[model samples]
Target: MAMSRQDSRLRYRAVARLHAENIDQGFLPILGQDFLALLYQAIDESPDSALILAEEEGQVCGFIAGALDLKPVYRGLLRRWPALFLSLAPSLLIPTRLWRIIEIVRYSRKAGKGEAVESLPAAELLSVAVAPSCRGRGHAEALYIELARFFIERDQEAFKIVVGSELEHAHRFYRRMGAEPRAEIAVHGGTPSTAYVQQCADIHVSR
Candidate 1:
């Protein structure tokens, strides 16, 4: 659908609502309960994070979560003053904060083993979902385009996405977005996950 100023307010509201609902329902399934709190903090504190939602008649049709890595900043701070994150660790270990810690540790170990470089400043195209009734209406593409613009504005180096091995449709969609397969990480289940990367410079250079 062609989004216009006339639909902007309604669309914004739908985006906010869909964002909250998706965090509570959609993300929980994929990230697991162990990682939800970290996901929440990542979205809340990262200035580059955003939610792009498509709406029709005040109803949300689709949404995607975009997040940038704060690792660069964290690493710098730790290097300059080693005690900061260490001091903050006590509070982060409280029952409510432990989940994010667990998630970071788990992902850090995975990153160490995987070929995907964890040191670069990267953005994550975390999740995307379209309402069942709104499938095949181009809303998904619109949401992604909006997110691409947002990421470009931030001068991000690259955007990373992970897709389940069996989801051929999603794989094709990411390929259409110019994301190339970069790595594969084996999950607990027999199926491995595919990681895709699209560099901002590459996109601009192509255009």
Candidate 2:
């Protein structure tokens, strides 16, 4: 179903709840309260980040988190204020920058020769998930469509995403969306993940 921009608040809450619940699971067992607070802060402070949720009959069934690239800001903060990184050190070790390093390495190796890393477009599709009961109902696709529209409305030229090898279904879904495999990078403590890129100019959205 098509979603209205006015529903952003509801979507954000649902997405935040899903993210908190998932983190509570095996994804990042070490994420403590402080880390979660920091994460929320990051999202709240960034104009580029967004939380999107899918609902049916007034009940939230799935959600997706997306953001325009804001890494430069964080990186600058880390460099200028090393103490800040140190303050969040414990949390970083578990599910922040340090943890992401592992994934990057794994993906790099899988990317093989001739593949080069490119800067992601300003827009990115970060994370997406559906409730167990809502599986196979196209909620994920619907959410993606919403994200694309969001970017398009902002005049973004492209969008990108990273999908782990373990998420076979996601890989297929993205392929169907006309995303091309761009690079492979190792995810620390896990297998390689493939990076995919899709140009909005090439995407044909049907009404």
Candidate 3:
């Protein structure tokens, strides 16, 4: 089945399965039940972002979500729904998730260092997840291709994807997809993450 717009209800279910299936290990894990709810809300409200789903018989097999520009995404979500995200703030402050809070602050401080539009053309590959049963069926790759097309339509030429160092499978898959390590950042859980950049041309290489 082709990737299509995700309705609110489907988005909710996908987020739960994303965490429950451990597919979120490639990105950040949902910290709590409300985390997914809040995330779907954010993605729903953002104008420059998208959450696309690939379904079969009403089941969400794979999905990808990303923002063309991160600025508006944060502004629309965190700023408008500050209270909602703030409610989750306490969770990250817990001893087990303390590092997550720190890492978020760290990244916030670095936002000012983003390259100017004239200096670079890029987008963030926020997340891509496929159910375990959906693996090896080319669903992940298809979702990526659709994502790349979205960026290409916007005339973007590069994409940055951050992957946890511990997810070797994801790292290998990304490399095979033509993404190369560009830099590293310390993320939640104090984990070191490698940021891979895939030029537009590379993203379509396998197509």
User: What RMSD, rounded to one decimal, does every model reach?
Assistant: 8.7, 6.8, 4.4
lDDT by residue (tens digit), candidate 1, 1-207: 866655654554454444455444322333333233234334534565776666787676888777775454334334534344553455455754466445544663455344554543367786787876787787777777777777889887678887778778888888876888878765433347887887755542222
Which candidate would rank higher by TM-score, 1 or 3? 3
**What TM-score, to 2 decimals, does candidate 3 have?**
0.77
Report the Cα lDDT for residue 185, model 1: 65
Candidate 1 positional error at 28, Å: 2.2
Model 2 off-target regions past 4 Å?
1-17, 20-29, 32-41, 72-115, 187-191, 201-207
**Model 2 Cα lDDT, one tens digit per residue, 30-95:** 444344334434553466766566777888788766667556435433453554455456756555
lDDT (Cα atoms) of all candidates against the true structure: 0.60, 0.62, 0.67
Q: Name the regions of candidate 3 deviating beyond 4 angstroms.
A: 1-7, 24-30, 79-99, 108-122, 204-207
Q: Which clashing pairs does model 1 show?
A: none
TM-score for every candidate vs. truth? Answer: 0.59, 0.63, 0.77
Query: RMSD in Å for candidate 1, one decimal?
Result: 8.7
Residue-level error in angstroms, candidate 2, position 1:
21
